[model samples]
Target: MTNSTRIFLFFSFGYFVSYLYRGVNIGFSGFLIEEIGLSAADLGLLTSLYFLGFALTQIPAGAALDTWGPRKVNGVLVLVAAVGSVIFALSDTMWGLMLGRFVIGVGVAVCLGAAFQAMALTFPTHRLPMINGAVVALGGLGGAVVGTPLSLVLDVITWRTASFWLAALTVMVSLCLLFGAHDTAPLHNRKRPTMGDQLRGTWEIARTRAFWQILLFPSIVAGTFYAVQSLWVKPYLLDVNGLPGATVDGLVSLLGFAAVFGSAASGLVARRVERWGISLYHFCGLLLALFVVTEVLILLDVPLPRAFFWISYGFLGGTNALIYAVLVETFPRHTLGRVGTSFNMLVFFLIFLFQNAVGWVVELWEPISVGVYPAQAHIAAWVILLALQTTAGIWYFASKQPKKLEHL
Candidate 1:
């Protein structure tokens, strides 16, 4: 393979595994609840804790990636994730599972932040979008290809044993990273900025109108996306829409599959949109609005077809794919890691809060037992998530395009 192609494969493959590690916990969460006898709120708390660990690593992890390179940072962390998987596999208790999940979060946080930095560093500017898209789409394949299968595997192998094997595979990848991934030394030949200075640099950008598009949209996309995927739609369909459990599972599977396409499509769109002076934010936000509209349509008893949800997710994924590149191009490469880390810290916390908030809304509605379905409380939380996404959409359209900014 060509150097560029090799680099893409290397980073993308690592990312594929990273996504697997990140989502494996989410897949097993229901199992944790059923087998461990945890409540919905308790499950929310555990997932939130994972985000807490993920959030804590943002700035530091970013800095490490920028300065130390992905080999030292992301590669090694995947090995740590392997250990985390082992812990999770071994632990049967609630708290122990939480600890293991947290470690996995730490591994994932580093892997993603570094992957973006590396892709930016290694890939050519013009082809960046498609390459980036390929990475996301390919990486997302882990979820699409294996999410449900892995979940089913856990049924046969048990979560712990499956985790053990997954970790072993992750560690092997880590070793390959150590031996195969080469770190290009800094070309600028400049001393690295201190954390305080780096923080200030990002902070200044944060105040500018430009940074708002990058910073703000990600939160909405991540928060609402996680809120829904963490099984909000499943319960909504089962309790409110009268869909069967099998139907819900099939839809959930389709959602992950859609995400893979969304990731790739968004990357390509991001690349193309930048040429037209349109922001990826605008495209994503607009689609986010569409997704919510579909939900509202369903709520109102309109013939809100299933294609609407799938199509909307495609748009959502596309919009999200642009975020990292936006961050990469908007800042100096040296600061990419720091800003990425800081952004991720915020993103995960919001994800944690939003997911639970969705759950809270369900609980408040008072369980309405229908058929085999367990009724959740009020669904006001989903409404709120929809609202947040709408707000993001509004902000995106109101903002000036990147071309407009250049003219000024």
Candidate 2:
């Protein structure tokens, strides 16, 4: 009925699709590995492709939204994601699954960037931060819904069929965007540069030391956060902590529940940092991660303390919220959508690589001179992540300046 409602719906649709691509993997990973004979490594590598595809399209996606407008681009991308879901459902091999996931990867970058660009184009400037948080919170809801209990539904039916149903939902969402989820004004920025300029966006950012400042922090923050959440947490609970059945479910629920608050909290913090600020928001995140890893290591050395389960939850939740909210504020909005999408791509790619390598690195360490503690190994895994965040902090502090919301 109104412009605001239309903007909200349209943007929500984009995240809804982006998250569907994310959520389905957790639900189906176990089933697929068991049925299709994919190893844990295979599942990690293949699912990571979704992020890679998502990352790869950032610049183009932002430009598409800027030039083509969200209505057309969002519809096409959702349809493409639906196709990925369908392919994943039908696949019996790892390579086939990778192809399917890659489709999702490519489509989701468009979905995420287009949604944000739509918000920037349509919503009032003051509302963008909160609205952006709302989109992520919605996606987290989708993720929480797709966990073990939902996976049980896949048991009764086949996960393959479930995948098909998810795709079908995307198709429904695509229709929703096509008809109801649209704005009155089109984003035809006549003064904007040619398509070639848009395509060179990522490269342009790469050229600037300042871009690296904006770039590396998000890569570490998002990479480690998502990597752990997606690939390792379940195993961390099952293997490291020795949590079983109901306990595992409850813990997973805790992580997701914390995320709900974390997303909103991030936006609020960003708003609060309107004046002079002195903190390594992203680097502090890894420091928090260090605290988490060290605590987990202590728990491993001795008897389990029930307190840790909640304390660790709070620590991670706080970091997650801060990192996300800090993202929008860290860069210029002109290239916000492009940088955001590209950042997601790099985060995904690095998360997959580092996460996969950690295990082997640990194994290699254990047999050699230093006896390996797995928790310590993860702490070490985070060392490089923290260093990158440090580098990012130095750059953000020294080079670029953020504009006030009044100007945005």
Candidate 3:
């Protein structure tokens, strides 16, 4: 393979596993609840802990990528994730499982941020939107795999064994990164910034009005989408809609497939819209409005086709990938690593809060049946999430257009 193709595959493999690790919890949710007797609150807290770990690492991981490069930094982090996977597989108690999930989150947190940084370093500026979208589409492949394919694997083996195998696969992917991924030299020809300088640079980005404005939409939409997709949706389908396990798995798989297309399409659409003179902010706002509509439909439990609702959720949800591309394009290349991770930190932290909040909301209403919360409880959680997302959309539209870096 050409070097470009090799680099793409190597980084994409990390992202694939990053997504797989995140979505694997959905496939195991029923099993963990049944076998370990976890409450909805417990499930939400445990899964959110992964985002907690992930959020904590973002700024530091970004700094590391900027200073040490993605190959070494990501390789080491993925190893940590593999170890966490093993711990998770072996754990019988909730605490052990939570700890494992947290570490796994920390390990895989670098996958996307590092890949984006590498792409920024390697590719031309104008091409980043499409390239970034394609990378995210590859990550969606991982999400797709964990849906039906993981469900099939779980039918043949216990969740523990499946997790153990996932751990092994993570190790293999890490090794590939160590051997195959190579970072391009710094583009600006400046000396590498020290850790202190990195922090100061991050702080500069954080202080900008444009940064906060850009952050509004993605943080809310991406955070809510991830919280729902990673934990609640499968249970919601099985409990509220009363779908069979196989059918729910099929729907989730379809959601994953739709997300793959959505991720790929968002960049192309954004570029086309820009060519037509629409701002990225307005385009993103339009997409977020669509996402809110879908959430409202889901909350009302409208008597629509199940596949349409779920697939719409996944497709509209994936469009948030364009937000990352926009951020990359707006920031100075020297600070792109920090800029990407800073935004990611905000997004994941919101996801952590929202995920836990949804669980807490669900737990307020007693389950009507064993392991099944009331449908109204799920609806209540959706209402709160949707409201927050709608508010963010309004905030983005109200804010003045973000100023882009001139050097780009």
**Which lDDT values do the candidates have, in the order given?**
0.66, 0.61, 0.84
Best-fitting candidate, scored by lDDT: 3
326-394: candidate 2 lDDT, tens digit per residue: 445555556556655666566667766765654444444343222213455545555565566556545
Task: Evaluate residue 102 in candidate 2 and report its C-alpha lDDT on the 0 to 100 scale.
Answer: 88
Candidate 1 least-lDDT 10 residues: 369-378
User: Which parts of model 1 have CA positions greater than 4 angstroms off?
Assistant: 145-147, 184-207, 273-281, 298-301, 368-378, 402-408
TM-score of each: 0.87, 0.80, 0.95
Enumerate residue pairs that collide in model 3.
none
* Model 1 lDDT tens row, 1-408: 555455566677777776676556556766777788766666666666657778877766765676677766777778767777788888878898889878877877766666666777777666666677777777776655344566567668877777888888787777766776576546322456688865675566456676666567667777667555654555566666777655656666676777777777767766576678766556556655666676566556556576466446644554466667665556666666766777777788887787677656555544444212344353466567667777777777777654322211
lDDT of 3: 0.84
Candidate 2 residue pairs in clash (backbone atoms < 3 Å): 53-105, 54-105, 55-345
Ranking by TM-score: 3, 1, 2
Residue-wise C-alpha lDDT for candidate 3, range 305-379, written one tens digit per residue? 989988998988888878777786578776777888898889899989999998999899988877788778888
Model 2, residue 107: what's the lDDT? 66
Error in Å for residue 219 of model 3: 0.9
| Candidate 2 positional error at 324, Å | 7.4
What TM-score does candidate 1 get on C-alpha atoms? 0.87
Error of 2 at 304 (Å): 7.8
